[model samples]
Target: MFFTPLSLLSGLSPEWQLVVWSLVVTVLISVPFFVRHFSMQAPHEVTPFPFLDLPRELRDIVYENLIQNPSYPPCTPSPKALSRFGWLLPQRPAPSTSNWVMLSNHQVYEEYMDLLCKQAKFTLTVDQKNAKERDIWPIRSETLKQIRKCDLRLVTTSKMLGAEDPRTMPKDWPLRDKICERLRGVQKAEDLNLHVRAIGDPLWNPLWVWYHASQAFKDSAKPCFQRITFSLDTWSPGENLLARNKEGQWEWRCRENHFVATDAGQYLIREFCSALYAECQDCPRR
Candidate 1:
């Protein structure tokens, strides 16, 4: 067997040994970095997507085509109707298409929402019977800020508004007040149409209710709307009564019923515009 001489390694000075070890350590540390630097390939070139670069009108058209109808959950039927029917009726189903690509990103979603607010007749139903802050949760604050038009539907029951009782007012008046406050805070809404539906005696007038509600919005310091329309929906009997006259001739009678803004409601709207003019006059010039 060949024996290596220990003298060869042992005879080296401590300085020489340190120098050799330092060189070895340096090579060991630098090799991996050099290998990585040379071995890494350049990132793959990204393909240019021109969809975002299109004109705003063309982009809007593209987004409109991509938007699918929102899948809204079925509203629960009234308890009285359910009890009368003895079973719950199935609600209309939403479309089955799974493509909601427009809602995939924030930018496209905003575009779609803006289109809906501007072009479509978006309806927000507020059930005054079950007055809840969450009722308005379907609308986002950002959307509210950008709203150019709004159609607000307020549904009230006899019990909700105390329509049956002439002497007592609604117990949930504060909730209605809160809802008006929220509407007042919408800083960009321009055209507002309010529809009130009451489920009680057809003779139960809603003029006072409409006036007060409109007044609440008009009195806001920073109202966002220029035009407001108020309309009320009341039950109208569809049948006509036929009676025999004294001369033995048949007579037909029908009651004329229509849904339109009452005199007081129109007056309140005029007052609202006047108030807005007054406020504008008081403002300091920009």
Candidate 2:
């Protein structure tokens, strides 16, 4: 009683009707196979690896290997590419190319955030050109709290203060103010290594500057540290006062005739050491 395509073929000869039936049967047989073949073409979602299932020690090792000296973000394009109709686009933090594993998931971030701030040595290069902007380059207060060690490299010029006389230097100079402001940002660090390098001839003694900076840090932040070391980039043999020894340690050269000759230099040496050592008794230079 079922009326189907076979009924239409009934008016034809027996052979033709048989042929129609064969065609219909063949299509029916192939429909399910075709459906299954096409459905397999779709992309499939993959489950993330079970990294957290590993032991804590293994996780620490992975974190240590991946977290050292991360690559910096890319520089901005030329002014032409960044400008629109004579107007410059607002600047944003360059996309970081390092430690991207932290963004994998919330659990990974929670486990690695502390290690990133504590173990990795953050370097900040400060000079007059960029010191006016935010001093702590892309660091948050939460991260700043956990920072244990930092290298602060200050690029200074000789014209700011006369090498022959420290008395002529102003107490409230612009460079000193910027330097102090930068120091206050890292007051919580445990170990601080300060490197002072000059851009011109006749490198001046920076003890006076450090003395004031230390005093400012004490007054404002009540700084606490384990060890503080100072290094100078001197050009002249006479100016090589505090050269690091072969053992990669600072050798005290302040007692030389060049430094001891000037009462002002002697006073600065004593004051700088006293101020820094008062906070960090275990200074490496000591």
Candidate 3:
């Protein structure tokens, strides 16, 4: 093999190989020590910004945690209802007090069924205009397009009873393909877990599911555990949701940013956690 020791280190003698290995191990072992020393050498100036509080490396983690990955899986959409209306669930769901919580972004994306369902939604859209942005719902990119292309009209809720409907699963798997592509796109990274939470029943009270999903995770946290959050923007009121200008564009209005349903988030988090633990114990964890 090209990587055989004799081939790879052709010039090295047995003694030199031992020395090189020792050096490699020594280098690995010293990294944390050197890092710690340098970190200690820096002044402990408290920046007003929380992002600033972290080291440059840590700061990046915070951004990826907060800004870079700024989306959550909407609740588990009703896949069972997919066939008749196609996958479109909500044109818009009104905000609710029950939809809020803190969840480890990691745990939620670990094949959490609810988040998986949102992923299913991304695949079924055919509107190419704002398709990517709209379908990525809850998760967003600054450049992401808006959700404008689908032709959803409210057929009465009873249509859900139809059995011939197609699943929200896109007949084509481009959405899933893109997710995989993005993952593979990150070069040389050894560990990566996308923490998309499923807001189950996206068509039906999404906020309620989101709040409960987060609550499930929170309720499971041990006292020793540190809590984390999904983006807080979901619960914030739009600036001008109530007003419309003569020019015909949605106006922006509110100054408050972020959800404040702490009690609700906590409650749903524990309850869902209990249910998930029980379900996963019996079957493979979704």
lDDT of each: 0.51, 0.53, 0.32
**Position 269, candidate 2: lDDT:** 57
Which digits, one per residue and each the tens of the lDDT, describe model 1 over residues 152-221? Answer: 6666554445445533443346656666666665676656555555444455445445444444444334
The true-versus-predicted C-alpha distance at residue 137 of model 3, in Å, is: 14
Better of 2 and 3 by lDDT: 2
RMSD in angstroms, candidate 3?
A: 25.2
lDDT of 3 by residue, 96-189 (tens): 2222212434433332323222222122211222225524333433222221111111111112212122222122334334433332322322
TM-score of decoy 2: 0.50
Show the colliding residue pairs in model 1: none
Per-candidate TM-scores read 0.48, 0.50, 0.19
- Model 2, span 1-286: residue lDDT tens: 6776656677789998888889989999999999999889777899977898999778878887788542122244556655475344566545555578789888788667778777877665655555556553555656656667766555555554323455555455565555555456565576655555544444455555444443332233323322223444554322323333344343333423121211122246565454333322232443
Better of 1 and 3 by TM-score: 1
Relative to the unseen true structure, what is the C-alpha lDDT of residue 13 in candidate 3, on a scale of 0 to 100? 84
Q: How do the candidates rank by TM-score, highest first?
A: 2, 1, 3
